[model samples]
Every structure is written in structure tokens, then in C-alpha cells.
Target chain A: MLDSESPTKSPMKTGESATRATTRDRLAAASLWLPVVILSVTATLWSRRLPAELPVEWLGNEGGAFRSTAVFSGITGTFALFAAVAGIIALAGVAATIRPWLVLVAGMVGGSATAAWLVAAGFGLAGEPMPASAVPWMVALVLAAASYGVVPYLLSSRQRRVRLGDAAAGVPLGVGEAGAWFTTIRVRVFGVFAAVSTLAAAVIAVLLVPRDAVGASAAIVALLLVAAGFLVFSRLRVSVDHRGLRVVSSLFRFPIAHVELNRIVSARSAELRAAEWGGWGYRVMPGRTAIVVSGRRGILVERDNGTHFAVTVPNPDLPVALLTTLVSR
Target chain B: MLYKVDPASAVTIADQLAVQVRVAVADGSLAPGTRLPPARELANALSINMHTVLRAYAQLRDDGILEMRQGRGASVRADAAAGTVRLVELADALLAEARKLGVGIPDVLILIQKRGTHA
Candidate 1:
């Protein structure tokens, strides 16, 4: 149940902050997607400018990169075909269910764009075929693009309109009564999985994998990803008090939300099924956003901004009452 | 379990934190081996001094509610759950009764010490 990161993520999985779909957000999306769009257009332009074939380099030879010619049209044609197929699948599977469309765009465009740019950035200007030497830079480019994709996703996850259901009153507070609620939830299964992979990568690098450049570099990339997985799949800390509701995930101390009291309309305890949330971690839909984890039962906080945030925790009674009391006063 | 401390309340912040640990253990919100947030981090969250959180965690460690390590922060003791629940319940009842009887906290402690020696 703790496994949120499979190869195929539910398209419904979204940013924690599901800000309403707005022109401003779309502008930001355009800005972020700008680089990819440029790369795509530029790559095609270069393909047209280049002669019939691209100079492909085979670096496997012990001494130097062997220059071999391959048809640029073939690679470009394959990419176009792949993009079409992926477009169809994503449109069929993701567009119908995903909220705010831009996420779907990011999923589709971000992927193929990275694929296109990886090739174009490497060999487009080089004129000479790429060698084993160029492979490292290609890897770096892919990583850079992936991290760039995350930034826009994080931005888009910022705000959304939630269905304002019947408002519930908070627990009444007595005079001079003050309280705070705190809980930390860690992912058991995912954490273990990350730990195992991290250990395996370290072991392979240190003990088993030969010290060759490719082997060591592959191990390092695996280690880097595992490190990121550790952060993403780590723990979350929650507290609600006079300060309103606060959630801090261990993802580089990424604050999921810091909803203030005056901005909060109401709060209630509810059973959050995973089905409603797509899959675990932080999920965003048109009407809801959730930081889901174990125990399923959690407190839902409705903000003055008309967005609702749900977080999973073992015990909700005290926090619910605490939020209730604080809000009622 | 919610860790709440009200400066405006009669109870000290340290005791508020320490007692919350027992209640959490008692109620199973914090299971055995659950790693508590470091004193500094939790203090920042609660807007209190780091030392206050340290004092609370130190007291819990002394009473066997938690185990503190140099770098790993504090965690609930494995055997502290069942016993601490009953202890917390009795303590709550005792405090309520003490309030009704107008008995001061110092006197309650002295009474417990006397009872402890006899038992």
C-alpha cells in the first residue's frame, strides 16, 4: 500500500497544492514548457538543415569514437511515431480523469520533449557523431530536464478550487484554553524499499560492480535516484493549533501547506480511501487535494481559499477537536 | 498523538509534552520504536525553546517512556505502552480528585512518594 512510485503512476496523482486552473498558471506552464518547445522546434529545424544522414558515433571501440552515418529522419520518424502512440494512450487514459489539463500536458510533453532534446542537444551541433564521451553529458541533460519538469509540476500543484461542502463547526473552546496537535507518519513499505535499493546500489558500487567507467557511473546514477526516492518516500509531520494547520513533509522540508486560522473555514474527520486520491503521496484533483498515507482516517481542512487539504494520520480525534475548538473561537 | 503545550495553561510546557507521550503510547498513536522529531525541530514547530523540548524528552527518558540516542533523536520505548496507559489514566483521575480536594501538586507528589515507599 505504501508503494506510490510505480512505472505507471495514476494520472490522477498530482501536486499537493491544487490551485484552481487559471491563466496565470497556464502562463507559468508555458514559460516552463518554453525550453522544451524550443528544443522540439529547433531539433526539427536542424533535421531539415542537415544533409540526408546524421553522423552517428560508436564509442565501444577501445581507442576513439568510430564515425558511422545513420538517417536522422529515421530517429525523428521513430520519435514522431512514439509521440503519436503515447499521445493517444495519454489522451485516452489521463486527459479524461486528470484535473487542470496542464498536468496532462506536462506528462505528455515533458516526456517526449526530454527524449527529443536528449538527442538534439547532443548531436545536433556536434556534426561529428557522438562518442562514449558525449554519453555523460546526455545523461546530465536528461536529469536536468527531469528536475525542470518537477518545478512546473510543483508550481501547478499550488492552488485549486475544492467543492465547499456543508460547513461543520469546530469544537468549542473554553476561555484560556489553548492546545496543539502533532503527529509524524513515516512510510514503512516504501522506506524499506528505498533503503534496500540504496543499499544494493552502494553494495554494487563498492563490492561487486567493476570499477569501469560505465559500471561505476551507472551505479552512481542509481544511487542518486535512490537518494531522491528516500526523500520523496520519507516521513511527514503534522500539527494543528492556534497557528492553524501545518504539514511538513520530509521531502527536502517541503512544506505541503501552512493554512492559517483566519483562512480556514472548517475542518472534519473523514475516511480517505485511496481510490478517491488516485494513489498515495500527495494527490490533487479538481475538488480535493490529499497527502495520503497509512491508517486512512484523517482530518480534512477547508481553507478560506476554497481549497481543501486532507492528510492521513493514525489518530484524528484530538486534532479534529483542536482545530474545531480553535476555529470556533 | 497530538503534542500540545499551552503557555497560558497551569501545566508547564515540559510536563505537557511528556504527558502527551504517555497518552500517545497508551492510545497506540505512537507505537514502539517510533522516532520522535528532534527537540530542535519540534521546538521550531511549536514556537518554543529547544531546551524546553529537551527537558520534556529527558523527563520521558528518565521515566522509561522514551529512549534517546545521540543522533537518532527519541523514540517510544517498546515496553512503555500498556503500563503507561494505566499510569496516565490513574494520574488523570488523581489530578481530577486532587483538584476536587483542593490538594496542591507538591502534596500529591509527597503522597505518591509515601505510597511508593510502602509498596
Candidate 2:
């Protein structure tokens, strides 16, 4: 439902340049496919260097060499399976909000490191305590975590430079008059997940508390609670005033997103379904991104530079009214 | 509920807030027993003095529209009479019409007295 929406104007402003993802971005993301074929061939060749059987698990107490063996083809098939999974993610990324390249890199990072342990075992490092195989796995994990952020910044067109637009304003403020609106949205989706996760952790502690080593049990419980807290994603505090629209996290009070008044073209209250806009949390599409939570009352803000940013809030009318007023000024 | 304040307006900030609550109560948006945002949170959001919000709460409590406790924050009283809210809304409409017609509350009161006594 649209309320207090601005009057429709021409579909495209006459002097405006079209904003979009660059060719470089699409190619850089799609280029990830090359590795899939390359790895397929490489893994086929690597199996020839291996023996007739392989370690059943890569990270046993003394590492993979200590575990039971599996046929050589089985090991190669497993490695190829992971590579195929990564390729599928890359292919699907073009149509969805999830970045294809980032997920593919993560899959490869995990697949290749585990492959290293299997390769080491086949080439006569099969026995005599190969504990060091764990090192490459850990290193791969760190790299994968870092690349979640690094690869997107280096190769994607996620954050494009934006210029001011001719904003729309309607609500009037008299001379020396100012208005501000505020609301907090609790993300029920993430909150329920967090609660369930915490409850599971609590049940685990209850079962384990009867045993000795209270310190270890307590540590595990604490770690799980912290993870649950993170799972909350965030309680978003949104406000609109003379400074424009600001969204901040309730936990850290850190600014999650902001749109300056000068950059806003128009704004209106909407009834949004979070699933339709790409799941809860911050979602980025071609030229728009939406921050959705419990997901009903939302504000859709169209920016001057041909981009849009939407946020789900508990009470969107006040902000929509305030933003429309400020943008018009 | 929609809450807004115009510092330049003749109405005090507290009265603006209290009236918004009354209007919301009358419209049935703020249901009986619904909890209102804490005064500090409201103040922080609007960039207004915290005491101003407290004063609004105090007025609401005196009007029997809200219940406040030391630790539980504030909520609309379950028994908050509808007649009071209806009167508040009617008074608001009358005051608005009077303001638009370039008349004062005393003039409206005089007219109300003349009409009220007749009815």
C-alpha cells in the first residue's frame, strides 16, 4: 500500500546518466567459472599420482594418515563434488542477491586445503604421525573468512559513487520549526533463531554440568550465548531529522546506513514482505538495497542518482513524512 | 502512533505529546494496556528534553490514561475510560475549528456554554 507518495514524474530524467553495474564487475564475477574447469582437469591428473586407497578422514587425532582408507576414485570424486558445488553457487549468483564469486572462493578454499591432506597421504606421507596437515586447513579458513569481505570490495560493483538528486519534499516546517521521528524495529526472524540457538546451548550445559570441569562447560555455554547474540543480527534504531535518515544498531549504536536528505528523490511508506526483497538483514540487488527486519511497515527511498534504498521500520509514516519534508527543502 | 512536535507551535511539548497519546487512544491504535516507549527513548529520538517527556507522562497519569511504576515504565491503564478520550478528541476538533476561524478558547467556551445549556 502506498501512502503519502510523491507525484509521478517522467520515467527518466532528461539529463540523467543511467547508473548500473559495470561490465568489469560481471566479468570478474563470472570469471570464477574458469577455476572449476581448471580444477576438474587438475584433480583428474592428481589422482594418477595417488595410491589405490585414501584416508577416510583428513583431520583425525594424528591427522588423516591415522584414519581408515578409501578407494582412490572415492577421494577424487569427493574433491570434484566440492568443486561442482562451488560452480553451482557461481552460476546461481547472477540471479540472486548472494554474490557468486565470494561463495565459490570459500568452497574452493575449503576443498583445496582438504585435498592437500589427501594428496599428502597418497604420496608416502601416509603414516608416522602427519599432524602438520591441520595447518593448511586453518590457514585456508582464515583466508576464506578474509575473502568474504576482501573479494567483494576488490571485484564487485556493490558500492557505486552516488551524486545528489533533486529531492522531493511535501510536509512543511515553519520558520525556526524542526521535526524528528524515531522507531526501533526488532527483527523477529533473527530473534527467534537466536533464542532457539541459545536454548539448545542451555540444554547442552544442563546435561554436561553434572560432569567435572565446570570451567570448560561454562566456557562452552558462554561461547554459545555470544554466538546467539550475534545471530540476533541487530535491533535497528531508525531516525529521520534535519540530518536525513539514519539507521543504527541498538547494541553498538553504530551507524548501519544513512541517506543524506540531498540525495533523496522521494520517499513513501510501503507494506513490504521481507522474503520478496531477498530475506531479512541487509540485501543488495542491482541498483537497490533493502534493510528488512520483522517486515511490514517499510520506507522506500528513491535516490537522485537512480538508486533506491528501502528500510523496514515499526512505524514508517513519521519517517516518511519527515524525510519527504526534508528532501523537499 | 504518530508522534510529532513543533517547537514553534503555541502548544507546550508535553501537551503535544499527551494529546497525541489521547488521539491515539481515541482512534484505538494505542489499545488499552499497550506500553508506550520509555520517556528517555522517546526524548532521545525527538532530540527533546527527557523531562519534557516525563511531564507528558505525568499529565497522562493524572488524566487516568496511563499507569507508571518505578521500574516497569508506563502503559495505558486497562480501565482508562473511553469517555475521556472521546472528550479529548472532541475538544481537539473544536479547538482546531476555532483556531481556523480566528477565534480563541474563551470564545469557543462561551459558544459551548450557550449550546451545551440549550441541549
Candidate 3:
């Protein structure tokens, strides 16, 4: 039977101090998604511009088409400014069930605008074929966006109690938490899957899709569907190796959440009465918002936001112990 | 009212709690089956981590000084009297050491008397 005690309350509480650290890390993680989105959108736009049969009209230099470009740039930049602001807001919602929506909106707006601008300013003016290099970048952009969609689904694994067969068999904790993470086949497999899908998407964009449209529309749609397939496939395979206590998803293997035993000021396993600790995902429970997850009855660690890490794992205390060991060292 | 614990003291929080709980038991202040405060409440009272109290309780339980039950909280075990014998002996030894150190018998007595009040 489970222990119903209050567990331990960590000295670290959510206060004014952690605001800076939370903001900084959010920006860093959020920034990684941006470039990847931009590159993919550029690829898609360039692909559309690559088709031979599309009508090409050149605006005369007589009119202020250049001013029109400036106006176009201004309009797009305004949209970007809104997106950047929205990104900040979304980062705050990192603990939410659908917080990724913020990233989605930001990526779509930023990527589409940049793609249109590149086609109009560069390709349209030169009346030349799409640069070979741009193709990979565009593919990357789509893959990155797709990845953003895939991550939350994978990271949010089913929260049932761990089964007998699922525990980490004989892997020694001597390798330390990080070593344990690296040694897991499930984690490495996801990492490889993500890499291969990314490479596959890039290859298809660069080589398979022809420059002309005997069936350009169909070809582009197919490429997108293929990228989407990889994205979904990657998400479905994501699982947590509880014995290993590492986040395993296609393409992501880093230790996102673990409690270092020594650094852990307290460990609590409680059934929350109210949203006393607030809603699920990383939240502040009378303390820092570094890593808090609200489940049926889960563990709580008292540490700075970045200090304690949370993942959906079986036998919550195992990861808690693993985290404690990592931090204690 | 304010006894400072040496931050570098090798003494674990569990040991510290054992000392407190044992004192209460030895003096008959907390009768057998008396429910001690929950780990969380005691930890808050002492301004320490809840785990410390838990460790203390677990150690005490193993030593047959306290009994813990789900939902019901921890209580003084029936064998607390036996645990107190050790507590009394330790006190006697510490007093004896003070006398050997050339402290007056009156001074040693006063110190024990004062501590006994707190206990």
C-alpha cells in the first residue's frame, strides 16, 4: 500500500528569485525550434517556386514595386514582432497540456512569412531556378515544425503503474544516471530514428522532387505526408525507460528531468487537495516552477526550477531516487 | 529556546530527532501509544526537511521506540520504557564525564537538572 504522509517539503519555494532563470531557459529551448521551422518553410516555398509551369511575371522598375517590397517586408515584420511576443507568452505556458500551440503559431507565421519573402525578393528578381542549398534548409524547417508537434505527444506517456517486465533489468546504477541514460537501447533507438527521419526528409526534398510539375503539387504533398509520417512514427515510439529513468522519444535522449538525491532538499509523495500546487506539467508548488508534474498521486522535489526534472515514468519514486543520486553526486 | 545545531555536525537529522523523542519517552512526558506529530508538522516546527523526521521515525521504529501506521500517524511504542533505560544510562555517563572533568558536582547536577526540564 502507498504511504499517505505529506512526504518532505523542499526548502526551495516558488518565489521572485527564479523568474530570471525560468525566462532564460525558456528562451533557449524555444529558440532551437525557430531556426528549424524557418529552414523547412523556406524549403517548401522554394519547392513551389521551383516548378517550371507556374506563370512568372516581372513587376516593372517604373513603378515603386521596390516600395511594395518594403511594405511587404514591414507587414511581415509586424507579424514576426507579434509572434516573438506570443512566443514569450507560450513559454510561460510550458506546463500546460496544449502549450505547444504557442510554438505552432509562432513557427507557422514566422516560417510562411520568411518563405514568401525569400521567393519574392531573391528568386523572383533573379528569375533563376531555386538554389540547390535552399532545398535542404526548407526540408529542415518542415521537419523541425513537425518535430515540435511530435515532442509533447511522446513526452506525455501513459501514466499507469509500471509493469513487472518494464523495469530496468540489470543495468547498473554505477554508470551513474547519465551513463544509465546513454546505455538504454530504447533511448538510443529513438535518437537514431529522429536522425534518420531528418536525413530522409532532406534527401527527398533535394533529390526526389523534380524541378518541374509533371505532378509537382502531388509530389510536394507526398513529401509533406512522408515528413508527417516520420513525425508521428517518432512520437508513437517515445517511452520512458523507468529503470533507466531517462526521457526516450524519437530524436530526444537528453535528461530533461531527474532529482539529484543530495541536491533534493525534500521528497514528497502526496495526493494534492486543490490545485494547491497548480495544474500539471512543470509548475511551482509553493516554490520554484523548475520541474513540477501534477498526476493522480506523484512525487514532488524541492529544488530550483532547473534543478528538479519531471517525466511520466512508472514507479515515480525510482526516477526520484535516480534523480537524487544524480544531484547528490 | 534557541539551541543552534552545528551546520557541520556529523549528526544526521534522524539522530537529532531520536534524541528528542527518546528524551520525551524517558521522562514519561509522551506516554506509550501517544501519537507524535506527523513528519510534515514536526519538520515545519523544527524548520527542517520532512525526510529528516521520517528518517528519525524509521530509525526509532527499527529501534523499537516508535510505531507508525498508515493514516493513523506515528506513536510511542509500548517498548519505549526499555528505550528509556538506554537514555537514562547515557545521561548518567555524560554526567559522570562532567564530574571527571573537574566540574563541581553541584554544577553537573544543575546542568542535568536544567536539561531534564527541557526534556
Candidate 4:
């Protein structure tokens, strides 16, 4: 079961606090969806200004065929795309289920579609033959918007606090007793390495495959990886409370593992090597899962069910001591 | 909030746990109707016997400070604050009266017991 006092709930309480928190959450959601909304509006406006016919397909290097159906479809498609993206963002935000990747995907797809439609509309308005040059600009615009949009959303959402009243108290404790321990760890060196590697790989791929679409797709993949790497490798949060020990990625606040303290048979400090664990972020081998990043010191917890869990943190002594004391008790 | 019990301390774990709970209730750190950690979990965390934790919880329940039911963990009683306040007031008055009369706690207890037995 999940930890009873996990930081998933908003810290803001009822009355004035709740109202202020809700407003802040909504504003954050709006900021995340702003790029998509702006592109959608721009697409709609551009589509209206286009001539009755739109170039659907290029017949040759110099000429292309125009279809009135294509123009209407583009306009309708733009509106539908905006509505769908807006609805998803709104629901995710209000329900507090918003995932960073989901927003990134929405931004990429929405931005790309909007940009494509806008380019075609621009061609229709200018009465110029479709040119190859426009493709690169369109691809670059989409990639840039999608990549940059994720950063602010991720940063803003991390500021949200978890309140005690919002959580279902797992069990009663003696008054004046501490029932939980929580901390977030950021591995700066590893995150930077991962981000740089992703960008380098994207650059190499673009050089190898000169096609506009391929380059754009590669750029999108690279950006997504960089964003995900920043979230996964940069900040890891560990929480131990009455319910269990929860390790989560700070960006998504999604649990990497939730281990019940009762089920833990033993816990001790151990020297962890990335080579032994098959390297990196989160590794699962056989009956063991290891969260290894940077440091070589970690706490190895053996569960009653015969499974093992290890997490490498800078200072594992306190966590190990706490875990050992709890398990032994 | 935080709950802690030092196994190496001179005080019994049960007494330590009970004192902590009483102090928290008296100070309003634990609001009325707040569910407490389960006895089993508390015992595990403190490295003490589950029965010891239960004993502490029972002490609180008897004082009208907590409510416990099977399957549902312990929670602070709705009137626990008022109950705790009254307890403190009576304890202070008793302590002051005993001090003024140069009577020990044992003597006071014996006097009360003698009166109860005769009645």
C-alpha cells in the first residue's frame, strides 16, 4: 500500500488556503497549456484568411493541386485539435493527475499540427508554389515550442506542498511523536551527463538523416529524453512514515517503490557499485530493485517476502539507522 | 507529527509513549478526532512489544483521551482537549495542596484510599 502521509496531496487546507491553492494550480495548468492554445488560435485565424482552395498535394517540383475540401478539413482539424488538447490539460490539472510527459506530447503534436496548417495557409494566401524551404522552418518551430514548454511546467509543479489533513492518517501515534521522514535528492552531475548525451545523439542523428521530418522527429525525441532525464536523474525523493518507505521522482511525484516497514526483515548500510547493479537510474534484476545514482553508499533492505531494495543516497547512515531501528522494533 | 521512544532510556517504553501522547493532547499538537498510528506499527517503529504500545493506547483510552475499535485504529476523542485540560487543573490543585500541607504523594494516596475503603 502507498504511504499514508505521502506528499501527493496539496498541503493547502480548507477555507482561504484551499482557495488560494486551487487558484495557483489552475494558473500553473494554464501556463502549461498556453503554447498549445496560442498555436491553436493562430492556426484558426490563419486558416480563415486562406483562400477557398488549399494545396493538398504537390503534383511536381513546380506545381500542386488545390482542393476546397482540404481547406475546410484543415480549419476543422485545427479547432478539434485545440479542443482535445485543452480538455486533456484541464482535466489533468483539476484532478491533479497531470504527467510531465503528457504535457510534452500534447505540446509537440499540437504545435506541429498547428504549424503545418499555418504554413499551408500561408502558401494559400501568398498564391506561391509550395517550396521545400518551409518544411525546415515548420519542423524547427514545433521542436522549439515542445521542448521549451515542458521546463516551466515541471519547475512550477514542484513547488506544490502536501498538507497533513489531506492525507488519510494510516495509524495513530503517541502524541508529539514524529511519524514520517521525507527528503529530496538531486544528482546534478548525472543529470547533466544524460542531458548532454541526449542532445549530442540528436545532433548526430540529424546529420546522418537529412530529411526534414526525420530530423524533426529526432529533435523531439532528444528533447523528450532531456526533459525526462532532468526529472528522473535530477531529483529523487525518499519518504519513510508509518505506512511505508516511498521513493519517488520529484518531477512526477510518482513512486519508484513503496516498501512497508513491517514487511522489512532487515536493513543495513552497504557499498553500492553501478557496475554490479547494471548501471543507472532505476535497475531491476531478479528479486532486487536498485535506485543507484552518484554515490556508492546505500541502504540495503531485505523484505520478509525475499525481495531486496537498495537506494544510493549521499548519506545513508541516518536512513539506515532509522530503518534498522524500525525493522528491529 | 513525530513519535519516538528510546528503548535504552530508563523509563519504560509504555510510560514514555503514554506521556508523549498526553503531552501532545494537552498542547493541542494532536487535534481532536485525529487518527493515531496503529499499535503494531508504532511498536515496530519503536522496537518495542506490540502489547506495550497497546498498553499505552489503553491508558489513553481509559482517560477519555482516545477512542479505539477493532479494525479501526485509535483516534483522539472529541472531548479529549477538555478532558486533558480538566486533568491538568486537578493535578495542579492536588500538587499545590499536598505541598502546602507537607504531605507526600504516597500519604495523599493512602488518605484517599482509606476514605474510599471506609465509604
Stretches of model 1 off by over 4 angstroms after superposition: A1-168, A203-219, A249-257, A260-262, A270-278, A284-289, B6-10, B27-29, B41-49, B84-119
Worst 10 residues of 2 chain A by lDDT: A9-18
lDDT by residue (A1-329, candidate 3, tens digit) is 01111212323233223222244335533653454455445545655444332111322123343435445555555655565565555444222322344445565665555544554446545566456666556545534544443333233222221111111112123431221111111223434554665566566567656654365456556656655443332321111122222232222323344443344543443333123234433453222332222234444445444333333322344334333444444
Judged by DockQ cut-offs, the docking class of candidate 2 is acceptable
How far does residue A3 in candidate 3 sit from its true spot (Å)?
5.2
True contacts kept of 3: 0.00
For all the predictions, what are the DockQ values? 0.17, 0.25, 0.01, 0.05
How high is the lDDT of residue A173 in model 4? 35
TM-score, model 4 to reference? 0.37
Best prediction by TM-score: 2
Q: Mind giving the per-residue lDDT tens digits that candidate 1 earns over B37-119?
A: 77877786577889999999998887788999886789888888767768756887999999999999999999999999999
- For model 4, residues A116-199, the per-residue Cα lDDT tens digits are 555556677888756666556655664564564454345334332111122121233334343444445778886777677677
Give one clash count per candidate, in the order shown: 10, 1, 19, 14
Output the number of the DockQ-best candidate.
Answer: 2
lDDT string for model 2 (A1-329, tens) is: 11223332212122122223455445545443443454456556665554544443333334443343333334444554554455344334232334433444545553454454445444333434324665566445534533433342355455432222333334555655556665566566676676776776777677766676557576667768765555545566677776677787765557788988788878876555554456667878667778877656577788899887888876565567668877777
Candidate scoring better on DockQ of 2 and 3: 2
lDDT of 1 by residue, A1-329 (tens): 00111111112223223323445445434544444455456667665555444333332233322221133334434444443343333222223224334444454445444554446445745665667776666555544554444444454434433322223444444466455566777777768777787777777777655746466767767776976666674777787777788788754566776778888788766666665456677787765678777876777788787777888776565576677777878
Candidate 2 lDDT, tens digit per residue, B1-119? 44678787899999988988876676666678766777886786567899999999999898778999887678888977678777656777889989999999899989999998999
Q: Model 1, residue B112: displacement in angstroms?
A: 12
Among these predictions, the greatest lDDT belongs to 1
